[model samples]
Target: MPVEEHDPFEDQFASALRQAGGTFESHRLDLAARGETRGRKIRRRRAAIAGGVTGVALVGLGGALVLPGIQTDGGRRHSVAGSPSAPPTPAASPTRPSAMSADDVVRTLERLLPKGKFSGEEGRGTGEQLPPYARVVYDDGKGKAAVAVMVDRVRPGGSQALETTACPDKVFVPYDACTSGRLADGSTLMILQGYEYPDRRVDTKLWSAELVTPKGQHISVQEWNAPAEKGAPVSRSRPPLSPDQLKMLAGAAAWRSVADAIPADPRVPTAEPSRSQGVPGGSVSATLATLLPKGAEVVKKGVADPGFGYVVIDDGKGASMVQVNVQADMSGLANQLFGSGSRTLPDGTRVATHQGPGDKGGRGVVMWTVDTMRPDGRRVVISAFNSGTQHTPATREAPALTPKQMETIATSERWFSRD
Candidate 1:
């Protein structure tokens, strides 16, 4: 299960800001899709964050502040660091400051605001090759707000700089209040006040403040009540700074010389990649309750496998979830993951199927799948959902199983006798 080769946009913002391991082993089928155009795009454009580093290069690396001739609804402008693959100008050695000048980080963030009155500023200065931000729109009289800062880097002593301080992954982000710490010079700060839907459906709060720097920079400072962070509409109920002013604007030491002049992914890997193994969540819910199919009824279950799992059945006509995955050996990954409307079996086994239309938000819901494999690579996938959750909504209207009972439970042999 240490299956390698993956960087779907660094698993889309490392699974939209990861952190969860009180125990539940782990799970990741495209890390439960959070990107590929905002999760569950039904699997095609092959999430690699859409190739060659875009989203203006993860907004220079840690994302969330974003604002530099912004365009994207398919327009394109995003520039903030002289990019042409910016990254070859390093020679200084003294205690920092060879370059990076977003107007001295917008005058040290409008001279460390708090007496507030700031307004409409934009940022990006590290002599351009992009990755350093600072936005403004404060109002202190209480209403108009949105303050930003992004500066990036993180891989020094990696583990993504200790999970960028921690607290995310409430099964895919939905926050309310958070805090984290460490810093006597070792650096690590946190302070979340989440909601941009992890299933609040959308109350749109989004407060943030993450630090991390043991040399792998990653300062972030999100704010949102609406001025941006997705087609604005909330206006203001929270987000004017407080969580100790977002931990003093993410521990600002002037964003450590613009994260020491950002640049550190010269193709990363001084270490940090080897965690991915699955199957233990009660043996993946006892091998998906042995392929149920008689008046169903299972209630809710979860076990995002050593490979993946799920249940949530009901059969009396409402709730339906049914999910599963297995993946062993994988014959050098079947010609780039099954294509040309796959189909092979004559005992060689290959198959593929789909019914589709449930991309994460699950509106009217409906999905039914069956993907098999086995020339000696043993794979088996399955799906079904009229929904009991993929956030919510949709109680029925197809999918309690059937696509030939999900292709006989994805070509079963008891999922190859539980490996």
Candidate 2:
């Protein structure tokens, strides 16, 4: 019998060697045991196979699974999946930087800021709202400092809304404490004025700067700062707003800007609705007329479906039609999608199911979903339905379609004339 050689990494290679059978090559053993742990390696292989399956499905279905504008419970308001529905905007050019590194931005800001005998220290870069360009946060120790700065690229002109500090009880409608302005740079900056109640003292003033850098990129610097002493008089003194109340005001302003950016109609390039008709349609009436079962009350109306449109007619029993997206904002539709329980439609003919986050109906690459059922309880999933859980500025690529494309999507399927 030949003596067996002992390898230093034998234990690590043992499982793989056993699976490889009596004769194994040294290279094979090394390949299995090197770089990644055993479990990770297995998972990687599985993921690859899953990816291949997904690719096949996409090709077969003509990319319906990956539509743009899908909503999610997470901060994102739109789907990242490449869909033909919406194209992204062109990347704005990078602007000239005030400083190359975080340290530099901090140094420049410190030099520009007012100095005193206050205690404070500088901080590191969190991330660039834009790539390569970095954002640095600083604490002035006296509760005064610049929250962030954009050293490069400035976006061009647009009107921005500024709001005063007033927490509203009902957040659905617009609150009255804000104002909007168009900046000289064509980029609008909103200045939100703050005031103290009773005393009518100004608590702090905040503002956002939208600038179009020489290179055509857009950048906004948001900052706020409080008074020098407790109960001190607060006032708005100059341009480029102070960095006192940035943390409190940043969230609402950022998302509001994004909502403002979405066009009334995102589809164009074909025979759909004209530029004017695409604006968000009126609120969906939850009345009996619109809520009738697919074919019962009426038959043969066309509805918009994924990638194309289709028609359905109503039969007496219920309705015979493929479900399309119901046009209600994320709020009205969310409960129907993932509400705590189920509810019957206005017609009393259809009952729909609801599930929570991470549930089967709520899973997707870019957004969560909520599954609905027809009157008979058949499953139909509505993807990307979120009701204001959190928000981030929405970004778009080049326009996806023209007027012609929109018409094609809406009228592709026509229902037969009813008797």
Candidate 3:
């Protein structure tokens, strides 16, 4: 049976959540069920909370994860069982590495953490159905918190590696602070202080550190103010670990050995170049900037991504966020995305408009959208939010651009130009 196509608006909304590290587990299940019907995977790293619908090539602790380009082929590793309190040490020889057991993975995390009482411990070691992870509910005297860590690998200098370290745009992600830099050992590290919910509906704070070594060791550490990532009361004003502590935990050397023991995915060739499979995000943002209505001051812009771009604008009324997605060969989805309300242009183009409440749980937020498709199956979707981000309360009565203005921007010939 063919998988039914999802509503395009929902997909775009979920993409924003994924990039912002917002929780949307149902979306993940939907994407899994849809399977290959979804085209190329756009990977993202979640430093704090995890959710949103995208191809999660790797799993991480506390549901927070790193995104790699290709899916693992479920390769197996030789597991040597050990005690949770005292995991078996790997052999000295890198040539003859010993696999860590699930217990070993958990024990390593426990040992590296500061003095704390640990419970609800769980872990997946190398050769598991999913990637390796270790999570525990830790109480460091002040409060009980959830701390998790995951180790994986990515292609060195690949798009996955770069994305893992890049700071998310505040226009999409409402983080308090974020920093990314290279270490003395050529490792890239990023620490993010953000909320578990993009909307800040709850005050649960989330902080995380991501470290990618020169040899492709991908480590992510996440901690939340509550005992769990979600569905829990905030146990403290902030997460248990400070930014520096999170960084130290992620940079621990023990994880690299665990990464080494994990077997490689047979499907992802090692030499694959780190390039986008869609229209470069820089091109989209540049084009969108050029098409903005006169005198609209650009407050912020999104990171250079492929096929997606966003900008925050304030036309004197208040801050508003405008985002666009440029996709090629989307004709297969036209019938599902467009309906009777859509109209056809004289040049064989299709146009659809929508005005509705924001789907991301922000209070009093509205979304205005213009979706367009050319005869050649190229898709350009433009959406504006009343708030600077979809997850925030409305800052104005409506989006900066009226529906007609959005339509004009969506249909402009400037979008058709080559990057």
Candidate 4:
């Protein structure tokens, strides 16, 4: 007889937790001879709570990860590994890379990597001191995506290595990874996820890593991308000194040096929020009739998202975001930037309007930003990019924000005013 198939709910539950950035080892599940179906539903509910589900009223829609718990708009809850409510506002400026030891970093990375059947090679090389850390590179030839680990070199034991895991797999294994599509400029993009063992934190840390092509330049997954859509797009600097240079810089302890020095996530480069203005306890929403020009009507608001809110606003002209993440909803705004609305792509992906067209045939300007503090205080940013262009499905087609623009938006004084 064929082996019995397990309940799909349990499998989906484990998968969601992994995707939501949770680490649930296999041993944690106790389904042995137990009512498997009940266990699966319970598992999903737990994952939803852990990831902070933003009630997505899923109408007949299907896109990757358009599931129950994950944030449909790319942002996720940045909570401590175990807590439910907003992660404690970490003490230091959150959003920097972690510092660790070379040996520990590599060993931790290896443990996190998925096992077997992969066809890539793993080689290690050191790098020159790259500030807060030294560097080690890991590349298993499968496209240009490679891993660049940064460590704190000054500390005798500091050293770190970044590597890639296989993609499109079924179970949650160490080092499993994937990437965003290619940009207009001929570059392949990939995202890496792995367990990090830093000197400061004892528990395994899960972090996102972005690998950019051509010369294999690597930056913290969080730092490589800018925080605002209006800001100048950031370009990767030349590939840092080769692995040889890394070793020379840190000497025998380069890995440790780099690992220990990997800085915490950077501050939201845009106009930073004042300590006086804290994250709000609730969200805001408004009817389309109240805010948009005539013909434009407000569709239902997406479930409240702490980092960003999604509303379906429409006019015969088309619908797009009037404001994003600025409020729980779009109740207060003196000026309506037609450009600032929400739009749904042919593929069914919903994007907040920034500095682009209001919608097909729509017009106006809208601006906003998203800054998330990781459980450990590291930050992730997504800002609006202003420009005139129709929203299209192509990733390369999106207009980019300039550096000066980024600074201006970062410094904007009236982001949270209740007017």
Candidate 5:
């Protein structure tokens, strides 16, 4: 299934948390818990709207929305944009690096850009209210566009680093084009050419380059066709910076220096854990493929995430989408999710099913879902949609899988077994 779109509620909650911050450590812990919950909700809702099940899926860059911080394995974190709210004062450390000045950040950005007239410049220095970042409206004699750069740290070789450099799934995020690969310096880079809106409600283009180094420095550079990321008319057909320009800007050494100067959170562990640790054995897509009923021709498959996978199939009638999420330790959410309408099996597994119109603005689309959870808190959710994608009109009357088939798949023992 397509990854869930950003939740407005989570954004509001995060903003509220930042504003009410006491210590950075406390805020980070609270936000991390909230983020995990929001992530689960997003996955569940996205699959439900597109097909039927709800669970945690991979994170997608829906509309390129700026997150306060991107959390990774080993408690590493990075910011995509600097916040305006006042930050908690850092405890004095003898080795604490001097903070970068806000002016220095803006100057570096201006210098990196091609010859252009800049206005509405804004910046936040390292170790300030938030991570270091620079934003400006630039006129390159062609048209005015908004450009921004943010620098921080990530867990080297962690899932967040991989996700940042991976192209978003077209099913969830419709983009013109995207490319990702590793640089000579062992840094992964991704350049995305997409619109500011996933639905293309507006033509304003949003192009971005994200680079994550082996040493954990992360640099993100974004450009918009309009003079602002949102709430502005398109000033040009596209952003000013070409893909090559964006790569150069994101790989600049200055950003690395800025990243290095940021103080490390004491709560984060020094030893990084393997990205695959604690995740389900094998890929979700691989396991889903084994569980699929006969005669369904797979057309496309979603990238594997910790607990999520999806596939588009055709049974010679029309294209349909099926997605599954396998999450562990979800017993805490059972009462809230299953409710009284759910049924209990002899094995003490809870099961719930639903059929409804898709909530993702797709026309004439229907989603069917079967959700199941074992007594051990191992939850498996499977959903199928009548359409190949959630954003498009329905191509079939119903999903390829019936409610009974989905229920069987959701309750299969293969989800928890390595074999």
Candidate 6:
């Protein structure tokens, strides 16, 4: 199913979350689900990477997952098992020489599987600019099921390592159960039982194993209830592999060897942020407090989120929430963002105002928003929610503030103080 892209403000918000480890339901726009009919997703939670839907193609930790230009990109790495020392080909080739060739990776997966009819194999050798992935259909006679393995690299140690295995905030990435642990070799691994749909609205079961070796190689294994990630009907009550099987597959030494062969970008010397790039959440909240209307009672606030912040307020009119985000250098997206419903100020600022249902679909919850950008492409967006959350019934008929009030906040000059 083709997902529509979100508005510019939302695009900035989602990008902030992705970059800062804050969580939001994937704008879902442009998410490639491969196959399936999708209605507007309700209670959607985001996967850490969006993983880009159908099957996650591994990119390293921190910043920029590829956008899909071709639909139906799957790693059908089907290579016949060959000797370990086979001569290699180009990086994009399904089979490339590594500690294990593409066929070696495929054969290793088959050997690891519990007895069954194995066919429809696919995998990539260590040679690709893209990560190496192995996929197979395994049938224990119940039905054909999909099992996949992807190997890449990650930053070793600290939050970056844990984030690779940590479950997403439940509010954004709902899952049944998840656990993280240390292997005997000191590697970090996490197993999660989740649904194909973020809301668990569907019965398609998805179970995954995420592991980061002490040396920073990342091996991710995902198994599904059907033969495909999306567009396929459930073939079983659960995926073919159990948690232990998944752990063994992702933790396989052979995948680590493949990861070792994959080249690293010489341009990026380290894996973590060189310095924090986001504004302190405290400053944002205090700044927002100054701009709020009188008679507002501040409820709670946090200072960890870099580029975004939120404040819940009450004025005896019931509880309403407000959020704002600031982004810089967005000039390139002007044409795609500023069109009808948008007007320009003499100062060369573009402003767009909108009133609509909350993005999360809280019952009777309305959202009043203002989006603005200076000619330099510095953007500010402010939105007011009628209810604390979209999933709940509204306490007020409309957002606490009017669109014009939000417009004032969004267009304020003080926001430029950050840059």
TM-score, cand. 1 vs. native = 0.33
- Model 4 C-alpha lDDT per residue in residues 1-419, reported as the tens digit of each score: 00012112332332233223322211221111111122223222222222233222211011112333322222312212233422222332334233333344445433333332221222111211112111122223222112223212111111111112113111112332344444354323334332221111222222343223332222222111111111223222222223233222222233333333333222212222222211244332332113334453555453332333323444433433332223222111112211245333353322332232222312232333422222222222233322211122212222233333332332232234344
Cα misplacement distance, residue 343 of candidate 6 (Å): 3.7
RMSD of every candidate to native, in Å, equals 17.5, 22.1, 8.9, 22.1, 8.4, 8.6
**Model-by-model lDDT, in order?**
0.56, 0.25, 0.65, 0.26, 0.65, 0.58
Please list the residue runs of candidate 6 whose C-alpha ends up more than 4 Å from where it truly belongs after superposition.
1-101, 141-143, 158-162, 267-277, 280-303, 309-324, 332-336, 344-349, 354-369, 374-377, 382-402, 408-419
Q: Quote the positional error of residue 264 for candidate 1 in Å.
A: 5.5
True-structure lDDT of candidate 4? 0.26
- What TM-score does model 4 achieve against the real structure? 0.26
The model with the greater lDDT, 1 or 6, is 6
Worst 10 residues of 3 by lDDT: 34-43
Q: List the residue pairs that clash in candidate 3.
A: 281-305
Error of 3 at 330 (Å): 2.3
Give a tens-digit lDDT track for model 2, residues 70-91.
2332321222234443334333
The regions of model 2 sitting more than 4 angstroms off are 1-99, 116-146, 150-177, 194-216, 224-419
lDDT of 2 at 210: 33
Q: lDDT tens string, model 1, 378-414? A: 6667767676755555788887887777767767676
Report the C-alpha displacement of residue 188, candidate 4, in angstroms: 27
Q: Which stretches of candidate 3 lie over 4 Å from their true place?
A: 1-96, 269-282, 303-306, 359-362
**Per-residue alpha-carbon lDDT of candidate 3 for residues 1-419, written as tens digits (9 for 90 to 100):** 00111122222222223222323332232221121111111113332113211233221101223332222223212122332312344454656357777679889989999999998776667654334667778998999998888777777897667777767655455679999999999999988898776667789887888788998888878888999877899999999899999989999989998888866544445564333223543566667888999978998876555566678899999998887776666666677567778999999889988787764463788877788888887777788878886666889999999888888888887666654
Q: Considering lDDT, where higher is better, how would the candidates rank from best to worst?
A: 5, 3, 6, 1, 4, 2
Measured against the true structure, the TM-scores of the candidates, in listed sequence, are 0.33, 0.30, 0.76, 0.26, 0.76, 0.65
